[model samples]
Target: MNDQNNPRDAESDYADRIKLTVALLGKNNKASDVMLARQLGRNVLLEELGAIEEPYRALQPYEIDSNQRDNFAVHTREDIVMVYSLAVRANEQLYEIRSLVRILIALLFFLTVLFFISVIWR
Candidate 1:
């Protein structure tokens, strides 16, 4: 059978082309960026970055993968950035929560000690 006719072969070919294209785009660029630019147009990519959004804009279906509904998929640079931003934000929030818990615990301990002292004095 011809390679084109086989689903596995076709997928492999597609992935190879993606890798080649990414390489040609230069080391700074990623496969996902090329896929997004091709699928969403270059303007959309710039526009999304320019827009004020926390973390980053949510990725569209086409931006995620040229071939949607496929089990295997590639990610865009924006997706990577967004995920990283989210992780950082989550980490920061966790630190804040921990600090708050610590403060609350200290206050509780102080209050308990004061209550016992007052009872003993009375």
Candidate 2:
């Protein structure tokens, strides 16, 4: 029942990860620097110190609100900062994915056309 590889099992393991990240941000600590601090075994500072009460309430036990989770992921100081940085990285990655997909599709279409042309010529 306990598979370490699959986090999507019966128990919500990612919740702990998310909660840890949220706690870091709730304390007004910067999330982007959390990794460095974690690597150095040090503490990181979070951003917005004020707007945490709402998130805390949302994160209360038995509350499985995805919106709250998203809010925590986005609005929290550490989350917002980290997400913004991630968004920039995601956008760059997205551009690359889109370009790659376009190239692959074009090549496939060209190959298909060539196949049809050869068949007709034959």
Candidate 3:
């Protein structure tokens, strides 16, 4: 039975969305921009990206061997590009970057406070 709002299984739903990426990449898959546009809706795929395939994705029917690296989402913005990695080390890079940004912000805040104090003292 399907819930009216939820509709399909999350992973199964992701399969369709993931196809758009595969189609855009021209990864020898059973889809194209035109086809996806019809099935998914217009402008679903960014045609100008031109199949660079830099930000990795795992296609459906994932056939993994022992050597296969389990991927993780690394700060994806909607549909443009996403990063993934191994050792279940999926989102680590993005997390690390975010942590660094937080630290940098804290340091800047401290410096700003010091500067304000000096200005007030003068």
Candidate 2 matches the true fold with a TM-score of 0.38
Question: Which wins on lDDT, candidate 2 or candidate 3?
Answer: 2
Model number with the top lDDT: 1
Local distance difference test values of all predictions, in order: 0.54, 0.52, 0.46
On the 0 to 100 scale, the lDDT of residue 28 in model 1 is 51
Instruction: For candidate 1, give the lDDT.
Output: 0.54
Query: Can you tell me which runs of candidate 2 are displaced by over 4 Å?
Result: 1-78
Per-residue CA lDDT of model 1 for 70-109, tens digit only, reads 4223336556788799999999999999999999999999
Candidate 3 residue spans exceeding 4 A from truth: 1-90
| Deviating ranges (above 4 Å) for candidate 1 | 1-75
Q: Per the 3 Å backbone cut-off, how many clashing residue pairs does candidate 1 have?
A: 0
What's the TM-score of every candidate structure?
0.41, 0.38, 0.31
Write model 3 residue lDDT over 1-122, tens digit each, in one string: 22344444433444666575665667544555546445443222211121112112122233435443222122123233422235236567778889999999999999999999999999
